[model samples]
Structure formats: structure tokens, C-alpha cells
Target chain A: MNSASPPDLLTRSGSGLLNWLHGWRAVFRFAGVAIVESLTPRTYNSATRSVVLKQIYFTAWQILPRFTLFAALLSYVLIQIVVDTARNFGLADYALEATIRLLVLEILPLMTALFVALRSGAATGTEVVLMNIHNEIQAIEAAGVDPNRFEFIPRVIGGAISVLALTAVTSSIALLIAYVVVYGPQYWNLPDFARVVAHIFDLPTLTILWAKVLAFGLAVTVIPITEALAAPKKLFFAPIAVLRGMVRLFFVLMLIEVLSLALKYI
Target chain B: MRLLEETPDAALISDSLPLRANLSVLENVAIVLQYRRNMNYDAAADRAWALLGRLGQTDSAFKRDPDLGSEQRFAAKLARALILPQPIILIERPGLLLPDTHYPAFLDAALTAVEDLFEQCWIVDYTWNEPLYAPR
Candidate 1:
């Protein structure tokens, strides 16, 4: 039977607070573990490379074509709207800059996070939680296998690369789309496109975007694994662990975006 | 008897305990592994998964990697999946809040696929459960 009603505000807020705290604590802790684990030689073994590559291959490579198309369409639509609206307002000079900012700095990576979250985040969370609940991670450890290097860090690395790779591909294509829409299909705007990339992606913006995408990807994998570990060793909390992971992932993605925007503009 | 004899469907979560936290995943099992009748964590976990069937519990998580699966299909996939089964099979809750964005579908499909394997599957813990325990 369903509760047929939501929890009272006090309970809802209390649990929300707890979940928020616990979720972040897990993230920081996972990060610390990853860093320490990374310092060790075994964590970077051949197995780790293979695992990381495979993770990137599946999570990033398989979806490359589809993600690029989706990003292209979204970028086209957005640039058209921005360019048209900017012209209507007689600020056509700012149109390209605005489109790049919107598409490159803001939209694409976040969309990638959402895509990974939908595709891999859930799976990672479920897998980790199951592993935690099952004791698989420990088994690896007991067998002289550093699970972090062998299993987890590869995931983190893969996720970061996926975000970067996807961003690179989509941002590149969208810039082309933006120019085609703005100046028609001609070489005249190549200089302008390069200028925008140079201007909008100045050293600071480039650094921030790179950092933000990395952070976003790390959060996507780290948060879920942390929450999965936090799940009680009972059958009921698996979904809850994943749920917490997804919510925390979204929050972290938003936070990364805001922080990057702040670093760039503010 | 026949139904009870089937393999139990159980989930298993594996993680290193935060160093700051008193209960590393291994330490959390200190009670069962070290003190209990002289079984190590691996042995204890194996024992636990086996006991689940008798408890009428089909799929539960053990702190061991039983036949592990991945988030998605990939190259060399067969090689990794062929690795050892998790040592402990603990029972955990269904992953709702963790990190699965493809919730209703990925999990739903998985659970539905494993339905015939277990007699009964229930989620009762942090992040473990089983949906594929063989029927008796």
C-alpha cells in the first residue's frame, strides 16, 4: 500500500538535511581515498589503465556520435534564438559571444553530466552499492587487490575524460553550427569564430571550464559510489542509495556550473 | 524443499571504510569475521549468503562480490565479469537515492530479468539486495 501522502515538512526537511550532509561527507571521503590511493604505484597498474580506458570507452565513446548530434541540434536552436533575439534588440555584436557562453560554458557539459547520470551514474551507483552490500570491494582488497586503483579510480578517470572528450567534440561542432547560422556557409566567419573562442575561452575561462568539467565528471561517479557505500546492508535501501546519489550528483553538477561561472565572470 | 534448495538472490556492496570512520568495511564485519566461530571475513560472508536461503530470504547483499556486473557493456567485458564472485553476499536496500539516473528502466529490467531466479527478493538494508536467487 502507498502512503498516499508525502511526509510532513519536518520529517522531509530532517531527512533532506541528513541526506545532504551524509552524501557530501561521502564525496569528500571518497575523494580523499582516491587521492591517497592514486599516490600508490599499484593504483596505476596495467589493470587500472585497462579499466579506465574501458570505462571511458563505454561511457564516452559509445555515445560520442549520438551526443554530438544532440548537442548540435540544441546548439543550433539556441544560437538561432539568441542571434535572432539579439538582433531584435540590436545587440548583434554580442550574439556570438552570448551563444558561445551559453552553449560552451554552460549547457553542453551539464547536458553531458545528465546523460552520464542517466546512463552510467545510475549503473555505477547500483553497481557500487551492490558491491558494498555484497562485500565485493572488500574481497578484492583481501585478495591483495587495491580496489581503488583496480576498480574505482579508473571510473573517476574515465568519467573526467568522458566529460572533457564530449565537451571538446560538441563545443567544436556547435561553434561551426553557430557560424553557419550567423554568417551563412562561408569562410568569412572563421576569424570571428576563432576570435570568440579566444576571447570567451581566454586562459581563465578555459582553465575554469576544464576544471569544472572535470569536477562535474568526478562528482558524477564519486557521489554515487559514496552513497552506494552508505547504503545499509539491507535490500530496501539500494534504490534509496541510488536516489541519494542522483540528487547529490545533480546538486554537484549545478554547483560546479555556478562555481565556474563565478570564477569566469565574477 | 525443492524451492528452498535453489540458490538465493542477493546483492553485495563492497567499499573501503573511510579511514576517519571507525568502521572500515572490514572492521564493520569484525564481529562476524574475527570473533564468530573463527571464520575470516570471506568465510563468514560466504556462510552468510548460504544462510539467506534458509531464512526464506532470496536475494540480499553480502559483503562479498558474487557474480559481479558492470554499469554497461564494454570491450573485454567477458574477462572482467569472469573474475571471482564476491566473497560476502549481504542484503541491502534497492538503490533509489544512490546514483542511478536510469532508475525505473535499468533496474526494472534487471529485476524483471532475475525474477525467475529467486523465490523471494526484498530490500532491507543500506545498498544491498538480491533479485536472482534460484527458485527451490
Candidate 2:
């Protein structure tokens, strides 16, 4: 039905690679702007605040209960498996530490980021692409309104906060579930549990965990919006924008996880 | 639209009622003041209320955009655009906003408002054989 120029394979692949790199470059640049604007006290006026609040409501508040329940279910299952496996091998002492490190330090944050990325990040990309297609950004600019301050930055802040808040809640729930599964819901093991918690959550581990969570939070929203903006202002490019955003999100999530692990172990 | 890039004092009101549909009226106006004018929340709200009053849209301040009628929505968009101290405004598709019976009167009033606020305005209407809202 449609006839267009089909470039040679080399040119096509080369252009594709260049576009991918360009997308990442835009992401980092936008992330820089968001961080700077988010820090500036003047950027938090009524309009941007409203944007941020609406974003938080959709990304964090609306999905809180369902996400927590799901995280608890997963946590319980994982804790049971880790505890059972350790006991089977006569390694019960290491079970609690492993669970704490695995669930609290690594898995919870990654899972939270991935979940938010799939829901809110993808939605944000779609919204941004739609807005671009409709020339809303240019319209806002024509009105002397900075789209970054009013639109993109708020979404980024909301996404990051949402990821952070969800990670905290899910990780806490996972800890509770892990304790119950391992220690049989008894108060006598509180001291023991606290000791393991303190040991596994030492200064370096805690610092890395915090850094990783923050990175994940930033990536989930930032990458998608950047990808959306990189899309051509045609309706057909909307799905492609979302697809690229999601792929980048998944890659960044895994990369953060790997880097954290490498820093901790390697 | 060409004048906009050179001057920060330019405004645009679109046919789509470009204000965020999810936000309340006060929020829609207040956000522009805060982001563009660097006003605090309370100050932005105060300025927004005053602007809404100036446009005779005080009653629609808190209502959501989805609840507003076409004319009221136009008024809201105009109010947001006018929040900045812009000296030029470019209204896109002024004729498309209202019915044939209402558009002429609406354009008259809008032209009056723009004349009072801005030195120049470009009302883009493809149907007009002559400039309806020319520099007057």
C-alpha cells in the first residue's frame, strides 16, 4: 500500500545505532535539566506542583495497594524458598542474611522500578508523544511557558518519587513477610532479626542500596520521556517511542542491578 | 507566531482549550503565573483570581476544564494566556471556538480584551477573507 525508500542494510543499521545513541544522549541531558530544575526552589510554583501532584496520584497512590500485595506475595514465596533451601543444606544461619540481602538490598528496588516503569513510565512516554504530535509543547512555548518546568520536570519528579515510595513500602512489606516466614511470627526473635538486619544493612551496603534505588527511580521516568521526545511528531511514531522507551528502561534497570552487584561482590 | 521567539511577552490561545484538563481553573491559571512569573502559590492564586475577575470569569476559578462549556473554556484559556505580561498574542482558530451566532460577538469581545492588554495580536482564521481582529 505504501512505497518508500528502502535504504541499504548498512546505512539502515548505522542510522539505527546512531538514533539509539542519540536517544540516550537526550535522556541524560533531560535528566540533567530535571535534576537542576527540581532542585531550584523557584521551579515549584502552583502549576508545576499541580503537575507533580497529579503525577504522584496516578503513579504512586493509585497503584499502592495492589503493588504492595503483589510484592508481599512474591516476598513470601522467595523467602520460603531461600529458607527451605538453606535448611536442607544445613546452612540455616546464612538463610536470614541471604534473604535480607537479596530481598531488601537488590530485588525489591529493581522490582519496584520495573513495575513502575511498565505502568507509569510507558504511560508517560505515550502521553508525551501524544502531546508532541498535537504540538502541545510548541503551543505551551508559544505562550511563553517552559514545557520542561511545567510538564516534563514534574513528570520526572513524580516518577522518581513514586518509584522511591513504592520501593520503600514494598521492601518493608517484604521484610515483614520474610520475618514471619522465617521466625514464625514470634517476638523472641526480634533481637536476632535486628542483628541480622544491622549486619546485612551496614554503611556501604545501605549507601549502595540508596544510590541504586535513586538511580532506578530516575531512570524509570527519565528514559521514557526522553525517548518520547526523540520521536518524530507523527502519529505513527507513538508506538515506536513507547517501544524504545520500554527497551531502554529494561536495559537501564538491569544495568543498575548489575553495577550494584558488581560493586558489592566483584 | 514569529514574534513569539524574539519576545517573551507573547501568548497563544488554541482551539483545543490548551489548559490541562485535569487541573482546576485556579490551578490552570496559577501554574502559569508561578512557572512563568515566578510567583509563589498563594501569590499565584491571588494574581490568578484577580486575572479571572478581570476576564469576568471569577466564578469558574475552581471548576475543572471538562466541566466548562465551550465559551467558558475559551475564557479560561484566554485567562491563562493573559496571566503573563505579554504584549503580543496569537490566537489560533478563533472562529472555530463558537457557533456562527456566537463567534462574531466573541471575537469582538476578545479583540477588545487583546487591544487593552497587548499592542499587537494575530488572530489566525482561515475562513476570513479580511483580517477580522487586525491591529485596531
Candidate 3:
């Protein structure tokens, strides 16, 4: 066997880098299409409507009770820890602001996305892969159906909606819990709590929060479907597709969190 | 109708797999009419039911893929194909399902039933005397 020369090694590394970039480009392309198609009113007929309903049912409705309870418990624990630590350190004055910033601005949205991604993202990715392997997508195309409109777009919309709804529910509960934990559920601290919340969630912070949550929602579902679509049409490749999707999803979530934090603090 | 392209305008009914296994029969058919024919939900469902009724598939109309038998699935897929208002309809390996003896009679009856909405129905099967055959 002949070893590669310097030029050959450089060429091989260059091609590998190009292939990696091309892979990411395809993911973004699919995401753009999903977003554009989802916004089109023509995409939502009875068929896709049913799909969207089913997706929401699976992604949001089924897990609402347990997921909210878990989030509330987690929020309570984090708030208690932060408040107690701040009081001990003689920084109690900043406890409310810090708690809100931690839970509302950061943790809750990412948690909701991760929850939905683990449950629904994996399922959607596997389903798409199986459909691809069995040529169901091809069959849909043969039937003159736009799979993007009927299949992927609705699922993406459903996933995004699910993320947003869950995030709202959990974040609201966390805010309530934060109040109770700090102000002892008394009505006397309403103005104080409101001022802190309003200050922490000012216009720019609110905008960033919404943008970050939407980004998380879109990434959780869109990345999985994109990965599944990119996978080779084989049964063995399905698991690999999901694994890659989940890993990419985690990276994306962390990246969003980091960027949001940088925007807010740095 | 370019059969070799990645996204074809024509509907394909494959003998080897359910057309869309994740969807119910009605959804599978309605998706075709809704997306391809650009009809609304009610209109697409109405047309889907009418087509299913015409094909004697009203029984399996609402059933999911796994619940339907081989013949019911085939009929559902055929309904999906016929729902498209395309000029050329491609039927692959008709010999696998529509044996030569039943090919002409089946095509004639179905074509007549639909009032010849399609101009050409290309049935591809290697066993046929020719590589490609079109019903007149």
C-alpha cells in the first residue's frame, strides 16, 4: 500500500472539511424549507391538520402533567438553592433578579426543548428514517403529494408549537414558584415581585427570550428530521441517524444558551 | 411525470410497501388530492370518499395501514394514484399485481369508471411483450 504525499493528505483533509460543511448546509436548507412551507396557508389541509394535531398530542398533551410537575420541582429547588446561597452571602437583594434570570431567561426554555426533543424528536427522526427506508416518501411523491407540506412541515410546526406551549406553561409555573419561595405567597410583595420581574424581563431581554425559545423549538424537531432525511435509506442507519440528530440537537441547544447568555451579560 | 426524477408529480402504488404507512387510508388519499389537486380539506375528503366508494374501498377508508389487508391497502394506494389529476399515470411492474390476463380488462373498467381523466397510463413490467405499454 502506498502512503499519501503532503498534497494528497491536504486534499483529503480539504475534501473532508467540504463534506462536513455540505452536511451542515443541507440541514439549514431543509430547515429553511420547513419554515417557509409551514408558514404557507396552503400547506395546512385536513391531512396535514391531522398530522399536526397528532404531533401536538404526542409532543405536548401526553406529557403536560408530568412535565410541568417536574419543571416546577426543579425550579423550586434551583430557586431555593439560589435564594439561600444569596442570603448567606449577604446578596439577598439580588436573589429575585438572579432567580428570574436563571429560570425564565435560561433554564426553562432549554429544559422544555430538551424534554420535547428526547421524546418527540427521536420518534420523528425514527419515523422519517423508516419512511425513507421503506420508500414511503417516494410513494407520497408518486401520489403527487408534497411531502414537505404534508409530512415534514406539519411535524416541524407541531414540534415548534409544542415547545412554545410547554415553555410557556413551565416558565409561568416557575415564576409563580419563585414568588412563593421568595415572598412567602403573601399579596404584600406583589409590587416588589412585579418590579423585579419587569426589570429582568425588559424589552430586549423579552425579545431575546422569545427568539431563543423559538430557535430551540425549531432546532429540536427540524434537526432530527433533517438528520433522518440525510441518512442512508437502510434499517441499520436509523439508529445512527437518531444518535447523530440527538447529538447535534444538544450542541445546538447549548450554543443557543451560550449565545443568549452572551447577549444578556457579555 | 418524469419517472426517473427525485420528486415526481405522479403517484406511485408499490406492491412491496404501503404508500404511506404512517397515515390512515383517508389521510393517504386526501393528502394526494389536497396537495396535488389543490383542493381544500372538505373537498379533498369528499373526493377521497367518492373515489374510495367508487373503488369499493369505503370500508377501509378510515383504517390505518397496519389494520388493512393486502388487497385493501392496494385499493387505497390505487385511489391515491387516481386522485392525482396528472396526464400520465405510471404503474410499475403490473405483472406483479395485474397479471397479463387481467391487465386490459382492469384498465378498461377503471379507465371507463373515471371517465378517462388521464390521457396516458404507462404500465411498466419487464414480462410484458414491450418495455412500456400505453392503453388507448
Candidate 4:
């Protein structure tokens, strides 16, 4: 009760706000640096290409078959649920539209983002933090390597590609599963299914979907790496940085997904 | 013989090395430096001399001596000397040695050391059962 008075408290609160702003100023500045580097011709080196390839291999290539199956099964189950529910509510005509919107555009990207975020995001965060702590990045820079181009930007590119490839594979499988669930192995409905695909994945919708996936991937890899790099060499703060990165990544993924949904639906 | 109670404090002591950096500041700065160029050590030293003098090193031998006074002092000096622009994480603390009353001062000093050395800083801490890993 005898702490700083109201005016003092206001000053303290303003200081906290200023502190938060200062922390983000560094982040935004770094992000600007990343963007400028990304626009340059040297951004596409062999190392960068290899990092992108490795990210794709780990994210999309390795689990492609499993993710497809999982997406297919999940799509089938969800299509059935939506169809049955819609039919019970006497809106069976909306089954195909709802299923496509839900499975292909919504759940798949979010699931892929979460999956990648969990696997690679944590690793990237820890790796960046350790490198920061150990001064390895400094060593690299001292040796005349642009650590951002050589090490980081490539990861960002790789992550975006991985998200795109994974989403493509999963969405395709989900589409196939949706058809099977709705029409039950009948070739007669193939054209009808194609029409729905065409309708749902219209140009604008497709563009947004792809962009969102890319953004999701970027958020997962970039945010964590950035945050980890933000952490001090103190090992204890490493985990906290990671935690913050993950939370921010999760928030960004949700925001991207919701923004995409709002753009598509509303 | 009075046995020290094996509370968190005792556990903290047994694991001194792990907690050695417990109060240290950690930072990762991907980009830094007001200016960078290919320069010889002599010029770099000349540039860094004033900043080095301002540091509160008590030992005259350490202040003027070519050799670093300690591991921590050397790191702080090198970052200033080299002007290398890279992501840096620096941890500075008296470690888990001081009492809680003195921790704030220790923490401030450690952070100041790291902030002087690098742009990014993290304060590593320890709690019960936090995962500690050796770098591969």
C-alpha cells in the first residue's frame, strides 16, 4: 500500500510500456534487415538452397505418406460428421462446400503449422540460443560470413517451402478422402467433385491459402529463431525465450488462419 | 557435525558448475556495430582504448596488462576490440554465490558487462528440475 503513489505508479507503468516498445524495436529492426537481405540476388546461394531442401525433406518428404493418410482419414471422418449433421439439420446441399472449407483450407494448414512449429521451431530456437550463447555466430561473422544469409534466411525460405509442400500434399489427400466419403467410390460424381474443387479453390482463395501457409511456416521458423537469438547468453533465459517464441508463433499462426478464413468467408 | 540441509540451496551448491552461469546474462544479437571495416589490430585497439579505460577494473596490472585479467574480462574486451558484427549472447553474473539481498546488484553488474559486450542479453536462471544440456 505504501509503494509509489498514483503518479509514481503511472510513471512506472509508462516505463514498462516504454520498455516493451524498446524490446520490439530491436525485433522489428532485425525483421527489416531480414527482409532487405531476402530481396538481394545473393540470397539464393547453394547453402541457402540446401537448407531449403533439408527443411522440405524433414517437413514434407519424410512424413508425406503418413501425413497424407492422416489427413485423408481425418477428412473422411470430418466430412461424414459435417454431412450427417447438415443432413439432420436439412442442409445437405451445403455438405461439399462446408467440408472443403473446413478440411482443406482450415484444419490442414493449422495442423501443419503446429506440427512444424513443434518439431523444427523448438530445435531452431534452441540451436539459435546455443549459438548465441556460445558465440558461434560471432565466430562465423568474424570469418566474413553473413550469418543471416548463410544460416538464417535460408531456414526462413526452407520453412516457407516446407509448409507449402506439406499443405499441398495434405489438402490433395483430404480432397480425395472427401470425395470417397461423400460419393463412395463412384466415378459418376468425379466431375461434380471437380466442380466443387474448382469452386472452393478459386484463384483468390488459392492465393490466400498459399500465402497463409507460407506465413505460417515463416512464423514457426523465423519467430523462434529470432526470439532465441534475442535471448542473452545466459542459459536460463534460453527456455523463456523459446517459450515466448512458441507462444508468439502460435498466435501468429492463429491470426493468419483466422485472417484467411475471414477473407474467404466474410 | 551439522549437515547442511539438502534443500534447493544445498542442491544449488552441489550443482555449482551448472549454476555457475545461473546469474549470468545471455544475449543473441544477430546484427550489431556502428561501423565495420577491414582494419588492423593496432587501429582497433586505438579505437577501443577509451571505452576500455572507462570499465571499472580495480587492478592496474589488468587495466594496462596485455593479458586479460580473467575469462570474463577478456570476453568483454574482445567484443569491443574486434568490432565484429554478429549475433551475440552474453551472460554476466557473480553466479549463484551471493545472497538474495546482494543478487540485485550482482545481476545489474552482470547484465551491464554483457550489455557492454553484446547487443542481445539473456539472464540464465535455475529452478527445480530445469533441463540442462551440454552442447554437442
Once model 1 is optimally superposed onto the true structure by TM-score, how far is the C-alpha of residue B4 displaced, in angstroms?
Answer: 30
Best by TM-score: 3
For all candidates in order, the CA lDDT equals 0.63, 0.82, 0.81, 0.62
Which has the better DockQ: candidate 1, or candidate 3?
A: 3
| Candidate 2 local lDDT, B1-136, one digit each (tens) | 4545555555767764366655688887787777776777899899888877776778888898668877777778887777766677777776676544357567677657545666777666775535455445
Model 1 fnat value: 0.00
Retained native contacts per candidate, as fractions? 0.00, 0.50, 0.61, 0.00
TM-score of chain A of each: 0.88, 0.93, 0.95, 0.90
Greater TM-score among 2 and 3 belongs to 3
Distance from true position, residue A5, model 2, in Å?
A: 14
Ranked candidates, highest DockQ first: 2, 3, 1, 4
Candidate 1 error regions (>4 Å): A1-22, A36-42, B1-136
Candidate 1 chain A least-lDDT 10 residues = A136-145
**What DockQ, on C-alphas, does every prediction get?**
0.03, 0.48, 0.47, 0.02
Clashing pairs in 3: A142-B10, A142-B11, A142-B12, A143-B11
A102-202 per-residue lDDT for model 2 (tens digits): 88888889989988998999988898888888776776666667888889999989988988899889888888887888899788999999998988888
Question: Candidate 2 chain A vs. true chain A: TM-score?
Answer: 0.93
* Model 2 DockQ vs. reference: 0.48
Tell me model 2's lDDT, rounded to 2 decimals: 0.82
Off by over 4 Å in 3: A1-11, B1-12, B16-18, B37-43, B84-88, B98-120, B127-136
Q: What lDDT tens digits, residue by residue, belong to model 4 across residues B22-104?
A: 11111111111211333333454443443334444323212322233343343333333223532443332333433343444
TM-score of each: 0.62, 0.86, 0.87, 0.63
Worst 10 residues of 3 chain A by lDDT: A138-147
By DockQ thresholds, what CAPRI class is model 3? acceptable
